[model samples]
Target: MEFKFTAEEEKFRVELREFLTKELPDGWTGGGEEEGDDWDFELEMRKKLADKGWLTMAWPEEYGGSGASHMMQLVFAEEMAYQRAPGRDQFGTKMLAPTLMIHGTEEQKREYLPPIARGEVQWCQGYSEPESGSDLASLQTRAVEDGDDFVVNGTKIWTSNAHHADHVMVLTRTDPDAPKHRGISFLLADMKQPGVEVRPIINMANNHSFNMVVFDDVRVPKRNLVGELNRGWYVGATLLDFERSGVEYSAGTKRTLEELIQFCKDNSRNGRRLIDDPKISRKLADLTVKTEISRLISYQIAWMQSAGLVPNKESSMGKSFGTELQQAVARAGMEILGLYGQLEPDSKHSPLQGRIEQSYMMSVSATIAAGTSEIQRNIIATRGLGLPR
Candidate 1:
């Protein structure tokens, strides 16, 4: 298979890099501790990306997209991750929009897709509950049909970015008796209403990205139901497939590795550069090889998607390997930095702006989010290898 990018794709990459360099603020190193306080700046940047038709470039033109190719989409994702841009809403643009395009009704599409493509609306996912994280089919969130709405009740835990969301894509049980996975439905619930409450769930990194959202008799219009009633499990599966298949994690890991290598080259220990240490050089080389492998896996998934194939087992494998590698890189960073790695991002003496420290904490959640490593392995074993459950 041809792994190299075409000339046009390379040109697209260069153009994106130039745009990012010109648009991003001076002294910006991609991440910061003040992300939550920069809401206005985030909105402005998102709007800029939207105006350029880069937010949903892979989507069809009727949906406010540029109808760009999958290779362009890969290029965009990699560049965004490398630069650590803060604009693209993962829920609205990445997970929800594609799912809606595939399964949403015409009315639903007209109402939602445009605003998302314009980067005017932000969405949060409501899937995992207190009891149903890994085994999501056991989610207790219930939505009973009213006159023209569905009254939703229950809670969703580990919801990312609910505090800034305009809407929530909630997975609820519409029929409790019709089997665990068969009775579910996906609903677009407005977050401004009184029935919905969001509480922050601070992680070990002390970040406020995660939230616990409670829905108390939340009224959702029946028109907002995505796909068919009691058939959302299929839709959710497709969305997960999209979520798991991406080049961003690998790209981010590669950037981190490059930064770490630079740090090693510049720093010294006992009058010798860290890069000169045989042990450090070997570790860095090992990580470099693994990062390249992860990149290839991501490209393979993208290629499969471009060919109109659903990469079920392949997506799971990519997610599992990429996340695990991320954690490994974080661990290696901590080891390489020694006591300095424990310093928080805001610490004056911390290296790489304490990015390694923050990553070490954030990496703990990567293995569990989207789908756990165990679950991905199960998919690989049963679906890919034809092994017994």
Candidate 2:
């Protein structure tokens, strides 16, 4: 396959870059730290992207989206990551909306997808439980049907952005009698409903991005059911594959690495420039090669998606490698900065706006969240390499 971008695609890329350079909000970079909950920053950023029709570039035009090619979507993701613009909270636009587009009834699509596309609503995922982190199928959160309403009762830990979410795409047990993997259901629950409580779960950075969401007999209408009852495991797994398929790690981490390289040039260590070290140059060269490989893997996934192929293994591999590579790059920055890396954003002389310090902490979470490095390896070995688990 031809790896180079088409003439038209290259032209579009230049135009998008120019637009982002001109339009991106000042003082905004993708990483570092945001001051508030996911909903607030996401809504504002979504408006900026939505106004440009960039949020729905991969979605169909009938749904108020651009119906752009998958390559265009990749371009958009890359540009946004490079510009350090706030990301579209993955639950609404990236994870749930894609599943709804594929499986939701017309009513469901009309009800949910529009607001998400227009940046009018925000959502979070309620999948993992306190006891069921990696072993997702063993989750015991139950949703018993009563007439037209389903009463949801369980606690979901690490529910990212749940406190400020307008809705939650929740995975619940609708058939306890069925096998572990076959008894689940995906339901859209209104976060504002009675009996739904969100308690903050602070992270290593003292930031409150995750939450413990307790659903105490929360009533959700039967119409909120996604696909068929007791078949949510498959649906949720498919959606996760799509969610993990994006190339954020390569694009996003590369941005930080570039910034760190500049930091090395601008800053000093041992009365000399950090970049003057031969070891630093060697590490950067290796990182540059790895970044190129990551870009290739990401482009392959985009090409597969463009060709209407299910990107299961490719996405898994991409997430697996990209995330680990991010951690490596962050560690490299820490090595370069030495004592300066310890100085966080609040410090007066912290390097690169103290981003290296923030990334050093955040990158650890990236490896754990969205499926751990160990889990990704499991997927790649079992599914991609056809190895026995």
Candidate 3:
């Protein structure tokens, strides 16, 4: 289990890093919990990746993919996050691309994959409803069959990036009589159609990254259905597995922690550097250990993927460890900065352009978004430890 990259992989990482440096705009850093505005900055970054044949790098070559090794893809993610490149819009690339590759027909692949790869269109996930968050199986969004379309009527809350997305991959109750999971169908809907409305939800950071999307008898083409009828749960699970794959965030979190430490040493408050404090030092040490552990777990998941093994337990371990470690690092950052951490970026005297303040606020959401900390624990207990529910 030596996790060192091969010479070729090292070279690949450097090349991608250089490309990102040259292409990413001067002020464009990847959006995190605290990156102030949406501005579709990631769409432009994604297009750069697409132009370099880096977007959809893991997909098979026939469908606009380089078909690079899975480990290479993981390395790319690490480098991108390390550089603070715009956080990827997972709805299109991470979640839907894999689903379409697996469950979509040849026609669907030809039609959908290229635009997504090119960043010509954006997408959002429409999974959670007002009533369904962790208990997603209870979603009540319904889609009834019509002559050649499905008339959809439902509301999806916390639809990340829906305000900017060109389309959404939604889960709807296509068969109410069946068991909750079995009755659902995975479908795609055009966001610009007659009945779609997206309302922004302001987070604690006063940003509109998440939205509530309302569908008022929206008409979706029947061809948009993915996988078999009444089998959306399986399709959705595959996408979630993709979401939980690899622990790329560990390296980036470690890097950010290093930067925070440097900031503490350089900044003096009441004539004492924050790094001199015993509590801050101990917290950093703990976070360092946790971050390294997360990195190892992620590498294990990457290795399993290379061997064509399903990364059920390892994925859960990586995501759980990586996210928890990030939250810990963010907490430690706030402790080091003390009062200055409260200043917003717009203030004239804020430290690090208010980066730390934003990190603290956004970190609170990290444990809740994607999946909650509680849900991750449940997943690990049930799947990794083989515990009965």
TM-score of each: 0.97, 0.94, 0.93
Off by over 4 Å in 2: 25-41
lDDT of 1 by residue, 313-335 (tens): 99999999999999999999999
Ranking by lDDT: 1, 2, 3
Candidate 1 regions off by >4 Å? 33-37
Residue-by-residue lDDT tens digits, candidate 3, 1-389? 56588898899998987887787777554555432254666666777778887767777888788888878878887887677776355667777887787788888898888887776888888999999988898999999999999999999998877888889999999999999999999998999989999998998876778899999999999999999989998888877777787555697787778888788788776788877877777887788888888888877777786676667666666777787777777777777777877888788887767777877787786776667778888888998888999
**Higher-TM-score candidate of 1 and 3:** 1
Clashes of each: 0, 1, 2
Pairs that clash in candidate 3: 30-85, 30-86
| lDDT on C-alpha atoms for all candidate structures | 0.90, 0.83, 0.80
Ranking by TM-score: 1, 2, 3
Error of 3 at 88 (Å): 3.8
Candidate RMSDs in Å, in order, are 1.4, 2.0, 2.1
Model 3 Cα shift for residue 230 (angstroms): 1.4
Which candidate achieves the best lDDT against the true structure?
1
